[model samples]
Target: MAVAVKKLKSTSFHGHKEWFTEVNSIGQLHPNLIKLIGYCLEVENQFLVYEFMPKGSLENHLFKRGPQGPQSLSWEIRIKVAIGAARGLCFLHEAKPHAIYLDFKASNILLDAEFNAKISDYGPSKAAAARKYVATGRLTAKNDVYSFGVVLLELLSGRRAIDRKKICTEQILVNWAKPFLGDKKQLFRIMDKNLKGQYPQKGAYTVATLALKCLSTEAKFRPKMAEVLATLEQLVNPKMTHFVI
Candidate 1:
């Protein structure tokens, strides 16, 4: 089995030790979370070993090129990744005391050979959720739901969350996409062009609407990860009639 070793700064000995212990405690709790395999906490270097994801991170798939990741993901694969990520976050939220994954972004969502997505860098929430968590000095599971929305938007649009290369209006993905997300007629305008009109319109609309809900400024307005999972399942299997949020 392939393995990946991550190197952390050598100075933060106590921090690295805590992270090492935490990984051992939680890494194996779910299939969708990245599995930590080993570590090296030597005096000069710190390392974390994990199962090597052949497909790499979703960010690479969506934005970068060369050895970083795969070619543009197909519509079906994007939905599959989103569901897998939701499962990981749901597992965290269900913990006795929520193990909120602070970071929920495309780069942290790693994929394996079968295109199954697994979440990495568990304690780093960014974008809007990051702002809320830092501003209020409070972290909640709903914060994770917001970050998930950003990644979902990235998957749908095949765009970076913050692309400095783009014009000012398009640099911040959430801002640019929100206006179109809830409008059925405008939805296609923000969709990934790589999909080539192949995705199901109704399913796409459902996903877009769900994403918009997650992006709601009010933390309480976001759907729980379990509820989000239920919605995505319907897209995976149209016969699923039950929707719970």
Candidate 2:
């Protein structure tokens, strides 16, 4: 069942058409990605019919505060989400024809009623690819890994990507976090206070360490998306086989 539909932007109508063509070319059946049921071009409308997510974006879940407030996503669930997203990224990166996810952030991850994550914003993702080597290019598996790292940090620290007071210029969360993540002794200082010491310390440490690797300053240093998936799988299933990153 598709949820709300919005009109396409004037600047994006042409790009949207191109996106639709590319999506149709790929033929959607990816489990981790959102499915586009149909589109209407006659009306100059670009609507993507997608499964409804009652809980909305992961960004809201992590940052929003209300009566229903951003629930403290459990360590188990966070790890699950990490693996799920990694699976999605692996599919995108290694699958045929090689489609690259341009922008994958907490905001684009949608949660179904069951809280299973589905990566959305698929078709238009190509625009992200075209810009890859360009000065303005933003799409790359490494870039996606960077975004994923931010989400991972959010999971561990229960903090937003940017915290203003800690350092200058609204304090970039990743930079402030690097030194701490590298040091096992300084690890606890960055853990989410809300986690209440509930997570397995070593497991949490492993995850935080992985997140740092994903956010490496040199894109070449970041582990491949497949490796990331394997790592998270190892964290969850102790007996599962994995290669060292």
Q: Which candidate comes out best when scored by lDDT? A: 1
Give the alpha carbon lDDT tens digit for every residue of 99-135 in model 2.
6677778888877776777788765466454445444
Clashing pairs in 2: 131-137
- What candidate 1 gets wrong by more than 4 Å, as runs, is 13-21, 67-70, 123-137, 238-245
**Tens digits of per-residue lDDT for model 1 on 104-199?**
788888999999999887642222344466568677778889998998899889998899999999999999999999898888899888777778
Worst 10 residues of 1 by lDDT: 122-131
Deviation (Å) of 80 in candidate 2: 1.2
- Candidate 2 Cα misplacement greater than 4 A, ranges: 15-27, 42-44, 124-128, 131-140, 165-170, 238-245
- Model 2, 189: alpha-carbon shift in Å? 1.2
